[model samples]
Target: MKTLGLALALAVAMPSFAAPPVPLNTTDVDALVAKPAKGTRIIALWALDCAYCEQNLKALADWQRKHADVDLVFVATDPMSQSVTLEARLKAAHVDTVPSRAYAESTPDRINFLIDPAWGGETPRTMVIKSDGTRRALSGALTTARISKLLD
Candidate 1:
């Protein structure tokens, strides 16, 4: 009786652990992008200090909930060593279910160029890649309307 209650309380008190972010490197960029999305894939690039990044993440997460076919791949601009912080942020945004990656080894510029040469190295930037290889890179807060337009 008492033990059961105590066990339940402990269970409720425990925080759920999300998987650590995988390391994303320059050499692996092509392979990651090569895997086609069944529908449209969103490669969201964000940084911990970017204020608008959170808004973009939430908007994407909301869209994902309503669209199962949309694949989300969150890439944290910060190094993989900061996976804990990145994971926590993604978890809070409710997008951790899709998993995420953090930059590794290579310099940030190299990774940025590899992701998209036109990407002006900005946080909250998104790369909309379709199966046919048409890619659109957007910078700043990505709103619901902008996310929807990607499908169009």
Candidate 2:
């Protein structure tokens, strides 16, 4: 009985680990663009220091809960060293359960170029890629109505 009690206590005291962010490179980004999925995919690029990113993340989490069929991908533009904080932020937003990737390269420009040449390294950048390979990129926090429209 004492052993069972101790085990239960230990379990309760243990910290819950959030899903680790996968490393994303230029090749991976290229592949994602080249091999378009059967349905629409929401690709969100964020950073830990970006204030707007938090709002977008929360909105995305809520949106994802309602649309289970939508393919939502989170890309952290921060370096790999900040993966812990990135995970924490995602967990707090309740979107950590979805697939997430972190920029592996130290140079932000390289990663930014891989994502989009026109992008001026903005946080909370979102891209809604349709099944037909067409996409709409929006920079900044997304409104609930916009999210719904994008999913539709």
Candidate 3:
């Protein structure tokens, strides 16, 4: 019984392992955004460290709380670590909305490409794209009222 108990304790104490990172690229971004959202708005973007991004994330959390039907996609700007690292980061961050990583090697386009390369770059940079292919890049924190207005 003591041996069994020790074994169980050891198993419980084992550290959790996460998957590796996948790089972000344009093709992956296109593929991710291309999927239908049943007419919901899509926020496809590369993440970076910035105050505005945090505000947007917080706003998204609040928005999802009220409008469960609305969709919120998250993509890490890191092209180097796309899959495991990105997924782990999202999970760790407690982000329970749309999540993806930019493809590491993708064709160049206007939106998917990062605005600039700096700071490993900070996360939370986002773009609000409508169903009709219209898009608006959003920076800085947002409020529920602002989100509603944008959705409208």
- Tell me how many clashing residue pairs each candidate has: 0, 0, 22
Candidate 3, number of clashes: 22
> Between candidates 2 and 3, which one is better according to TM-score?
2
* lDDT (tens digit, per residue) of candidate 3 on 1-152: 99999999999997555344434555345655553455554463545444365456656866766775656666555555446555655556555344444546533233344433222333454455556665555444567766766666
RMSD for all candidates, in order, please. Answer: 3.5, 4.0, 7.0
Candidate numbers, best TM-score first, in rank order: 1, 2, 3
How far residue 28's Cα lies from its native spot in candidate 1, in Å, is 1.4
Best by TM-score: 1
Candidate 1 wrong stretches, greater than 4 Å:
1-16, 35-37
Please state the error at residue 49 of candidate 3 in Å: 2.9
TM-score to true structure, per model = 0.84, 0.82, 0.56
lDDT of 2 by residue, 19-58 (tens): 7899987777886544255767788899988989978977
lDDT of 1 by residue, 1-152 (tens): 99999999999998767688899988889976764746778888999999999888888878888988778888899998898888888888867776688999759898888888888788989888787877777888877788767667
Model number with the top lDDT = 1
Number of clashing residue pairs, candidate 1: 0
Instruction: Report every candidate's CA lDDT.
Output: 0.83, 0.81, 0.54
